[model samples]
Target chain A: MEVDKGKGEAEETRKVAEADRDTVTLKSSDGKLFEVSKEAAARLSTVLAGMIAGGSIDDNGTDLKQIGSEALENVVDYCNKHANSIPSAALISSSISFNTAPFKEPEEWERKFVDRLSHDALFDLVEAANFLGMERLLDVTCHKISEMMKGKSPDQIREVFNIKNDYTKEELEEIRQELAWAFYDD
Target chain B: MGRHSRRASPLDVDDLLAEILLCLPTLPTSLPCASLVCARWRRLVTDPIFLRRFRACHWEPVGVFHTIFQSGREHLSFSFISDPPPGSILHDRFSVPARCQDAGGGDDVYTWNVRGCRHGRVLLINMPCYDRKVHQFLVWNPLACE
Candidate 1:
């Protein structure tokens, strides 16, 4: 009976320790593990906040089966970087205004963070950010992609995005005629 | 968590595509130019819901429309002045009809006077040269060319 009582005390201690933990372990689709600050994860990602609040976080490694290892690594890196960086005054004010605020341009650090990624990596990170419900990350990544599209013609956009131009010559010409101003520079 | 099948490509998903497109520049030419990419993009951009969201996202005015009158010309021509100065393609597309059909099934020349412009729409009062009392109100949307 004494040994069982001691075992119960140890189990309670373990639970208490986990409750006090400042970081959470996440498992990628490929079974890789990543550690991120609990505060950062909860603050940045709505899904993570819900998971943490609902006590659904797994102490071993919360499985994120939708995210591959590379993308998950980028996500972790971004969270760590975001946690360390002090948000600017503009960001704080925008956060206060929330949805009504105009789209805020990504900061210089964020620009450099995404600019170093390969095209595939950037797309993968965007998917991961979206799946995890990381709004800021998704906004920064999407902004990077939209920047790639600006000032380019339809053919140039198609070439950049690798999309097929399904419109036949006649249909394309008709659309061009209808919105002639948009295509004048082309 | 329940297992879910992965999409073939991230850009293939409509939600993700909309998110990316939502971040496009606020310029008036952005959507029209993006719609030219493919039928799928055309469908997405032209969707009324997407258009509403686009307008909500970009609430700033991109250009202005004003009347240009020549020294001796009887008709007032409309001109669009792009705020950021887009290319020289703003001429013929923004022109309004100089003549409106009268009750007698004949085209009547009217002098158009600009009353107000708001929400991408231009309001004008058309007064026929023969009658000083006939005031016809015409609201023209240059973006829709209607």
Candidate 2:
């Protein structure tokens, strides 16, 4: 999960030295500091891009009070990795100009990026990604979560998401009756 | 500790969680099971907007159902022949149980015939009911019994 720690830090320090730095510092809700490439942040996150464009970014640490430190760290990590990774020609060509084109599957590295996180961390990253307007991150994380639910039953899904079966026994029976074909196939 | 054992904050937001579940591959099976998880989930799954999005994402029909009426010695039997995957052979079939027992008053025999079928439901018309001259219609979802 610590993606390119030495190189990322070195790049951040170099950006700080330049007259116009290419990196931006973000402060999580808990006051922890994380730095991400400014170009990547703007390109990936519409909210960050707007803040950067409107000069709302505070040099000390752009406060992201809505996101916790762990989630913010994962967001910054994803942005850095995205900046470094190159999209394949097929991926570039397959992307249509439509507003809601089918999203391309996550890359191998991106899959590994989320694969390492605990379920809590994954869900946190999803919320943080949505908060940041990181559409691709949201899609990738959501896809991963859905992948976990592919073959799981209702009881299993409840266990996975820590959701309580709030339906009454009668209601449960009725729903089970309604969707009996689904269970029979299993 | 197990990987999912952490008491993670639940993603309880309807839209957000729906968006995640909407990404599930098998909609017909997955969404129904998901709806049983909770009231909020059931609401989301059965919501008009959510169903529209789910249909848009998962566009293919799972199977086609055909209703066949057979005259038995004692009573008229209404059965549904399922030709799943469209062009495939008839793999599974089952009878649609009589929804209303008293459709025919007194000793008058009642027989059910398919009037129309659409959207995984069969509209059946009951014949020769002594109590009511008008044909009684019953909508039956045969797959629900499977």
Candidate 3:
């Protein structure tokens, strides 16, 4: 019984070591530990893939010099949490329903979760998503960014993105007048 | 330390940024405000590639309409010519309408005559302008009535 108990404890340690040690240690620009599973790490960007394949990522981890430390940390956390959930394909293909719904809500909690992000953070997340090859995540990020520019006047749009009026006043006026027919109706 | 291996200048950076920004779809947002702070940035935004990207974003949908005219009684008449798709939205999913359009406006094609139509089931009828009475023989195509 004593020998069996000792063997059981030893097996448990090995299992823990396997689970915990199997990681893609991403060293961010500021030297952070963005540990991720092999499956999750496979989603990383082209540059990272080269380093991963080359085994240049030392025993400690791979170094991601492009993305910042904080950003990399956030990305790893997102991946680890999301890895537990079902894949995107099964989720979207699954039929969803609600009761005889009259009044529609603007967004549910799930949508709100994604929506609650700053523009800069969203851009970083998109880069991360693209690197990770998270198609749905990338799509959501891009569409959110696109939504920012939709249906606003040219002046309003320029103002939102801090775009300089590079066009001369005369040129700007001409462009506005030419597309005047298009703007009013749509 | 004699010969310098020249690295890419600031212009290259601005050009790449401009290209990235241009790929996005039309939005109410404006860009290059930061890049346009200098003459080099100005050049990047004004590049032909940036302008071309904006040009490619949207296009006009082809419109087909038949302008109907009032005959004296409950009868009606109309005329239309199909213009090809404006170099866009031409996919296999689109099908030609059941009837074929016979071309007109030739050097001597008379406006009143259904000159060369072989299988046109409906003919466009034009009532004589300023006449209080509309033309009685609008339904020349027997298939249309059938």
Candidate 4:
């Protein structure tokens, strides 16, 4: 009985060690698995943090059914990159002046990270980041999209985003007249 | 994992769309131009909550409003002095409404003094020419042109 008790305690210790791992395995909707630093995942994502805190994380792979494999890969890549990058002085100072700063500009590496993505991949990553509650990643992705929107005509914007122009000619004319100054080339 | 087909665009979600739109450039033409994209975008950009959020996000002064008074003229003319990265705001985009200009009618000349400006609004005090007494107060929103 004592030998059995000792073995039981050893098994319990092994389970606890597994649960206390430094990294977590996540399963994307397509059933692919990715590993991320537990600390980084918890820090970067509110949903992951909640799952971690609530002890709901599965050892095999905590399922993220809303995220596709490609987008989840990008999320993992961003978290890993964020972990390695040092926060710049501007970032630190901006954090201190939180009330005055609306959004912190993305670091250079971050800008490059999202810049290389194809349009579909970028939008997919945005949805994934938003689903994971990753605020910084969402900001970076959204900033890239907004930059694409700047300086484009409405027709160009519609073309780029695959949006259908629903206004009749008369309705469009009325809006143009109402906000004529906005359309001035100068 | 099996490769799946592409998902729907995130912009289909209104909340996500707002997040993207919230980051647009802070120029005066940004929202107005965006409103012409589609009916959905038009509705989103004109929403009071979205406008409030946009104001909060881009709090820097876009331009200045100054009154130009010509001597012996009955009315005060306001001009927008644009501060720019090229085309921020047009000089004539904002104007004092005709109602305010017509307030002092038929020889009862009133001097208009700008009391304050805050949150895209201007407060004016209309004082009768014959006396120092405050005759009336007028609140104006040049953006709405009302």
i-RMS for every candidate (Å) is 8.0, 5.0, 16.5, 6.2
Ranking by DockQ: 4, 1, 2, 3
TM-score of 4: 0.82
Please give, for residues A1-186, the per-residue lDDT of candidate 3 as tens digits.
999999999999976675555577777777877677655454434444455556565657666666676567667766565555546664343111211122122234324545877655655666666555544454455555545654444455445545456677675556545433223322
- Model with the higher lDDT, candidate 2 or 4: 4
| Model 3: per-residue Cα lDDT over B66-139, one tens digit each | 32323321122222222322331121221112222236522321123222232324344443434524343332
Better of 1 and 2 by DockQ: 1
Which pairs clash (backbone N, Cα, C closer than 3 Å) in model 3? Answer: A43-A132, A149-B28, A157-B28
- lDDT for each residue of candidate 4 in B1-146, tens digit (9 for 90 to 100): 11223457877899999989999977667888899999999999989999888888777676565555344343445444443235544555555422233444456455667789877888888776677698888888766555
Segments in model 4 whose C-alpha atoms lie over 4 Å from true places: A86-102, B1-7, B67-89, B95-110, B128-130
lDDT comparison, 2 vs 3, better candidate: 2
Q: Per-residue alpha-carbon lDDT of model 2 for B1-146, expressed as tens digits?
A: 23365554535776678778778764345677678888888888888888778767665555444444345223324332222233211233446533235544445355566777565567778776555444777777654542
For residues A1-186, write the lDDT of model 1, one tens digit per residue. 999999999999999999999999999999999999997787778788789989999999999999999999999999899878856553344322442446678999999999999877888999999988888898899988888888777888887777889999999989888877554646
lDDT of 4 by residue, A1-186 (tens): 999999999999988997789999999999999999987787778888889889998989999999989999999999899878845543343222432345777889999999999888899999998989888899899999899888877888887887889999999888877876655543
- What ranges in model 3 sit over 4 Å off? A1-21, A88-113, A127-138, B1-146
lDDT of 2 by residue, A54-99 (tens): 8788888999998999999999999888877845442243212311
Q: Which portions of model 1 show Cα errors greater than 4 Å?
A: A87-102, B1-7, B65-88, B91-119, B125-134
In model 1, residue pairs whose N, Cα or C atoms come closer than 3 Å (at least 3 residues apart or on different chains), thus clashing, are: none
Model 1: docking quality category: acceptable
Ranking by TM-score: 4, 1, 2, 3
Q: What overall lDDT, based on C-alpha atoms, would model 4 receive against the true structure?
A: 0.79
Point to the candidate with the largest DockQ: 4
- Reproduced native contacts, each prediction: 0.61, 0.61, 0.01, 0.61
